[model samples]
Target: MRIAVTGREGQVARSLLATAPSGIEVITIGRPELDLANPASVLPALAAAQPDVIVSAAAYTAVDKAESEPESAFAVNAAGAGAVSEAAAKLGIPVIHLSTDYVFSGEKLAPYVETDPTGPISVYGSTKLEGELRVAAGNTDHVILRTAWVYSPFGANFVKTMLRLAETRDELRVVADQRGCPTSALDIADAILAIAARLKADPDPALRGTFHLTGTGEATWADFATEIFAQSRALGGNSATVTPITTAEYPTPARRPANSRLSGDKLAATYGIRLPGWKSSTEIAVKAILKNAI
Candidate 1:
């Protein structure tokens, strides 16, 4: 399968490039040539790649900064996503979009199902929700995968941030009140490839739609940090004491979901795919990071 994934250096895009199986071609399109903020550039750049599938992995993902730059976020996440789907529709191909768990208000007690009502509390979440709608409207064949708390060997994610801080600080403060599934970009890449293959193989209506794709388990930022430190210590790398704090203690411009756990049951039943638990994936990611650092 020839897959043209948006964003040259996004965590998911980089993971997709690294994990794409043999016989599957994955091309990344980004910047000057293909800018998401400039929707007009999307079609031409993507069409030139002539991909069998388009993975819309690019987006304005600065959660806190998004509060100040709603227009920039909306332009990329909402309008940019719509353009990609429309381009795929014109080319008679399916689009697999990467969305977020932030679409929810984090008020629910249990893990969020696909049918749960969306009430995005922050500008970033609102723009993503709008993107989801536009993707559906622009292309009938679309796979919108909503994931949360994603980290990997690459990029500026929580896991990496924690490890970096541990290099200097013995103790780090993290929010304990807010919970989410700390997902690995590598695992997401594997799942995306599987879903993409399935989409190319079959035009089954049951296969295409919105689905929650996250790590098998959940954890708060503190819990996640604790686990990362544990893994790093195991690898003889940077380790830190995680000081748990509440949301009230650390305020941001964008209000995060207090409970961001999402259910992966639908994705499992449909695709026969389930990502590994966060701890295992975190260890693998930590090992990779540590190995690279050495």
Candidate 2:
């Protein structure tokens, strides 16, 4: 089936391009030719591509900057998403959109379920939640996948940040109070492909809805950083020490969720896809990064 992937240059999109499944006929559209903010460009691009499925992976993800640039964030995340969803609806095609766990306020003690109430604390989260609302409103045949703490071998993420800092610093401080799972972009892409194939084969509009996608285990930012350093040391990269700190110690413009864990049970039950443990995926990612550095 033909699939058009937006935000072709992003880390997750790059990973998707690098490891996309065979026989999928993937077409990528980046900026200049297909700007997400301009709703006028969306339908025309969709018409030209004539894709059976559109993957809206493009997003304005500057969490901290979003506090001051709410308009820009909403323009891309909400308005842009609405455009794509509208186009897909017009053409009788399905859309698979990416979302975030930031939609939750993180006040809950347990992992967030699909049906849980959304209460975003930051501007980024609020805009993303708005985007999901618009996309779902525009089309019924759409899949909104919410993932968190995503890291990848190809993009700018926390894993890479830790690796870089480990090279120069003897010790690094990471927020231990904030908790979530570190999901790999490769795993997310694979899951997206599975959902796309299933949708292609089944074409069930009712199967489309919001679902949480994350790694198996839960961890804090400090826990994740410590694991990264440990893995990097195992791979003979760097052995920098990581010190745990509270979120209050490192304040940013955007307020992050202290507990961002998401439940993948619904996704597993419906899609029959199991996400691998974060540590296993991190091992593979760290090895790749180290090898590339050599």
Return the top candidate by lDDT.
1
Error of 2 at 117 (Å): 0.4
RMSD of 2: 1.0
Off by over 4 Å in 1: none
What is residue 109's positional error in candidate 1, in angstroms? 0.3
Best by TM-score: 1
| Model 2: lowest-lDDT 10 consecutive positions | 199-208
Q: Compute each candidate's TM-score over C-alphas.
A: 0.99, 0.98
Residues 178-242, candidate 2: write the lDDT tens digits.
Answer: 99989999998888888988877786655789999898898998888888889888777996887
Clashes of 1: 0
